[model samples]
Target: FGDGSFTGKGLYHVDAFEAALKNRIDENTILSHDLLEGALSRAALVTDVELVEDYPTRYSVDASRHHRWARGDWQLLGYIFDPRGVPALSRWKMVDNLRRSVTPIFWVLACVAGWTLLPFTQAAQWQALMILSLFMAPTFDIVNGILPKSGDQTPRGHFSALARDTVFGTALVALKVLLMAHLAWMMGDAIIRTIYRLFVSRQNLLEWRTASQAAKGGNDLGAYYGMMYGAVIIGVVGLAIPVLADSTGAFVAFFFAIFWI
Candidate 1:
């Protein structure tokens, strides 16, 4: 559903109350509800209204919900790509949702590809690539550091300050990434399963979980591993493949697999 309505903060968090049921919405699904609502409302009023949700307490529960959401978002591919009479804005909304759902899949694929090609790359090439990647993560910070303090349009010495800031920023980024390791694994888990159900197994595309269903007894590593076994397998193999390679591919893939553990 294409519309100009502004959904506050998050579409799931807040939106208009009034809604109309159409005979058929070209774009439809659990994830597309807000977009469809916005499309039908035709510029509904927006107030500084706060909506609160009694979300589940368990992290696994939350992950389960998002996993379902990932499927719902991927289901919109047909509507997004089809040349239908749907509004352009609606198509774009679907595209955005699809992009979010598909990014993790692409990330995992790239990881696999990187590992597969690692054996062919020279040691110098792989080493340089690794160094360049680390530096590129803080490219913006490096660029900002080029300019000294205000009114100090003076020439910087050999970009020393910029280089220093880049290294520090990259370290901070690496730390932040490590902290969110669990989240990254969960996201990848959701999308991979979404794709499997959507195209591989061709089941559970519309299956959703209630709060009660999502609730877990407690945190159990074995049970956790059961649900996230795919990520685990990928992580183990991803690391093994790089280490097995002769080049410095291990350095390139270490960060990718390290957080999974």
Candidate 2:
């Protein structure tokens, strides 16, 4: 704490001195002078430097009590710490963290199950079902991530801002996914080449490629290729099975695709 008395004394002196100085000072500049004096008092409240084992280092003054009195100016610090003085990463943020963790699981499971189950119900619905399921994964992922937890308490203003950001962010993600899927549909080989490019860009994939190349170059290409190929395989198989099934055969095919396959 700025020598507890110094902060108060400084403010008092500033007000008194400024009141005397005001007669000679232009009224238009009084606000600027008041701000300067307030800053000086704030500085006096804490020593210019604190010594730890006699080594001088800049220090922060305890301003929790004064922060509430700072009006609109101090509200900015609320971004750093809430009214509880706990930062955003604190355990008190349980609701936000819980929602973040649960969203991915919920969306992944829903899309996986839907793809695995829905296709066999109607053979004619193969194209619609596969494409819907393929797109649903990313769509649901983005939606759940952006959606506010019904039970969570958040500042109304912050939540509104977050909703606005989510709108634009989700649109961008959807656009990317659409373009990728379109390119994949138009040219199957392009997807594999794009995977190579993706492998180069993503550090994890690059490491996987290096390890695989070291282990057995060209020998286990099938296994190495299958890593990125799984998603496309799932989608293509989902699309193909319905084509092979008869009108009523799709019922059994759906069960095989979802549960057995």
Candidate 3:
């Protein structure tokens, strides 16, 4: 590709590589395309190098390094590529992710403290602050983007990105809170829909048509029974929330919300 030049061949090759990667990865994989793209975009922005136009410099790094050093470079790239690895809590990578996510929570707490000390503060204001803290979970993503644990050579750019991500993550969490509140208000409908689909609809459309006729000469009681039974199941789910289950749910929900939005 023009000896690492960012001309015709190099640009085409870069695009092809990215496209090929998109085709290869499973949509459900822990290290997803979205995560990779975000990481790379931040990398490029922080490095002050366009992936295409800056190819020469990066290739120079590759060329200058000892053959053995390639392993470390590849490992860092691999870690960034893997979702399971990027946000990994058991390693150094997690330290940055946690730091980024927690920064906003700390900021919010500081604000709450100031508010508490204010002469005009009241009980209602404190209650509002408590509700606001619920969205702290999403703030981590902002922190991750801004202060990525995967330290490359972009400290100044990282802080700038961190500031940007902090604002964006806060906005995203605010929107999610609104959506969750809406969904929670209609939590009964969600329960009903789950019951109908899982226990009622399938039976009615397939085997239960004949069974309903034989049992009562008319309507199928499975839907009603299923709905009743589902409530119990949902209640069990509610009970599971007291321990590790809720924490897991919160992590999942935070990511799911971020991805969809």
Extract clashing residue pairs from model 2.
2-45, 2-46, 120-254
Candidates' RMSD to native = 7.2, 22.9, 19.5
TM-score for model 1? 0.60
TM per candidate comes to: 0.60, 0.22, 0.28
Per-residue lDDT of 1-261 in model 1, one digit per residue for the tens? 333654433433233443243444532233435554455544445467677778777767877777666666666565567624556787777678667655555545555556556553553364345345545547866776666765655456536666678768878656544423344466666667766765678665557677787674447888766666666666777677767764465666676676665
lDDT of each: 0.59, 0.37, 0.37
Q: Which candidate is the best by lDDT?
A: 1
Candidate 2: segments with Cα more than 4 A from true spot: 1-89, 92-95, 115-170, 175-230, 233-261
Candidate numbers, best TM-score first, in rank order: 1, 3, 2
Candidate number with the higher lDDT (1 or 3): 1
At residue 241, give the lDDT of candidate 1.
Answer: 74
